[model samples]
Target: MDNIVIKQPRLYTPLQIGLGSFVGGPIAMVYLLWQNFKTLGNQNGTQYTLAGGILFNVGLLLLLPQLPSNFPSIVIPFVYSLTALSIAATWQMRRDAIQHSVHYRFQPNWRVLLLSISLLIVWLGCAYGLGIWLDALGIIDLDGSAITAGKDELSF
Candidate 1:
């Protein structure tokens, strides 16, 4: 009898994260980070992947809401667009691993996923809350109304 090798789908990648970030928001990137933490350890470019994930988040939480909300909100999509560069960097780090057979059919670890997501929720909350606190304390206003004299306006 001959042994068989079955190829499986690639579940997550920087490109995947980059694209998913647009459609799925931070949750998708979090999933990729969780996958990275589980499968790879301090691999070359791991920092970039992690940084990409974090930056994706911060860009959304800290920078996106400035867009006027009266119409289709481009904040999330726009932020994700810029952050994709960070995620792309990680693709190099993951190249070998992604091509390996081991990663193809491996079972995703649930504990790591839960941990990543929980930490993300707390981290995002704190970071976002800090922004709100700064606005409240008059340190810097992120509401986009400051420039328009307290009225949110759509502008190019």
Candidate 2:
């Protein structure tokens, strides 16, 4: 028997891939937090991921209503902020993973990829729906009035 090593497709650089994973991990954490919020009361071991997810989703949700409506005005800055956070978090995690001798394997598993993509779409869709529900119920205001006046007025 021969030892054969099969190479996998590389969609991005190690850094890029790590960053993608890092970005995704928090998003996953956010979904977990939302699940917790839906099911259980505020308890232990949910704070860190919950807070991070809430902050990240808040930043993202702030941009959604303005997306395609305002364009280059508001969405760009929000995107920039998201990118900066993703990159910074990715860098930190990558450094830690390297130090801990984490294995960086790039296997092109269609099942895993499809499942992940589907899960992401569902998660984002649910978040958007939740935002809309909250907005309608006045539980939270997407118009940013709670933050500042004229904040939600889409400006170019």
Candidate 3:
């Protein structure tokens, strides 16, 4: 009797998704989820993930400033990571298991690392742009005028 070899699809584990969420925030979560949906040939899921991710990101931006100043910095990342993990497990894990069982190979860690770093850079660029916009609108000053003034007074 000959043994047949079966090939399994590569997918990201829920834990990996969660870590990506933690490191790259919501963008990474959205991307990982979208990729899974696309791979599974779930067009509806792909569309919904994109739309939901946009709404969630907008809502998060709007609500973040409303949080109390004393809010712990760690809580936001924790919440998003847990949410990503839950979503990945609920929507994709079942298919992942049903299709490949224990034979599935996980997506490479290098891809996740590259994604996290790339998204982090994108996030920082957005922040910088927002700062420039706010400064232009006179909402906040980004220049060093106040520091210069203080130094001038002290020098006298």
Candidate 4:
């Protein structure tokens, strides 16, 4: 046992700050994960993010279709956590690969890539709340009914 060493597993990463804040949704998450896989594959592939991506896709497949506009309050946090988990796990794998001298850089399109990713992040973050807020503001009719029909009413 003297030659054996145990490593404590880390569950989160600083990457979650940007990822969760901006790309913390099903579609953007999957795209980011795909980028991760493609980038890492060019260097040294890691199956961890692939599995996470699969899980995210599967979740999207099953839960996305059935989700109502008014999802549970808990769902946002849950999905954010899942998104954070994926980014954190993949970042860890990427760090490991880079430490081992795996070099993979897709040059010549960095500007386009940056602009697109920035647009995507902003679009996603804004879109997530826009519809709900619009509905809340009565600018959009969700089946022609008031969402807050009884929200402020006191029941006896």
Best-performing candidate as measured by lDDT = 3
For model 2, residues 58-114, the per-residue Cα lDDT tens digits are 766664564664456544434543553454344323334434433333224453345
Go through the candidates in order and give each one's C-alpha lDDT. 0.56, 0.47, 0.79, 0.48
* Candidate 2 residue-wise lDDT at 31: 45
Instruction: List TM-score per model, in order.
Output: 0.46, 0.38, 0.74, 0.37
Q: Model 4's lDDT to the true fold? A: 0.48
* Candidate 2 runs further than 4 Å off: 1-50, 66-68, 72-104, 107-112, 138-156
Against the true structure, candidate 3 has what lDDT? Answer: 0.79
Q: Which ranges of candidate 1 are over 4 A from the true structure?
A: 1-24, 27-31, 37-42, 74-104, 108-120, 139-156
Q: How well is each residue in 39-130 modelled by candidate 4, as lDDT tens digits?
A: 44533333555576567545544444356868775665466546555664645354444335434322223433463467456545655455
Q: Candidate 1, residues 45-132: lDDT per residue as tens digits?
A: 4565567667766665765445565757766565654465365454423444565756453334453355445655665676678788
What tens-digit string does per-residue lDDT give for candidate 3 at 22-94? 8987778888888878877789989999999888876775465456669998898899889888888998874
**For residue 29, what is the lDDT in candidate 2?**
36
How do all the candidates rank in terms of TM-score, highest first?
3, 1, 2, 4
Ranking by lDDT: 3, 1, 4, 2
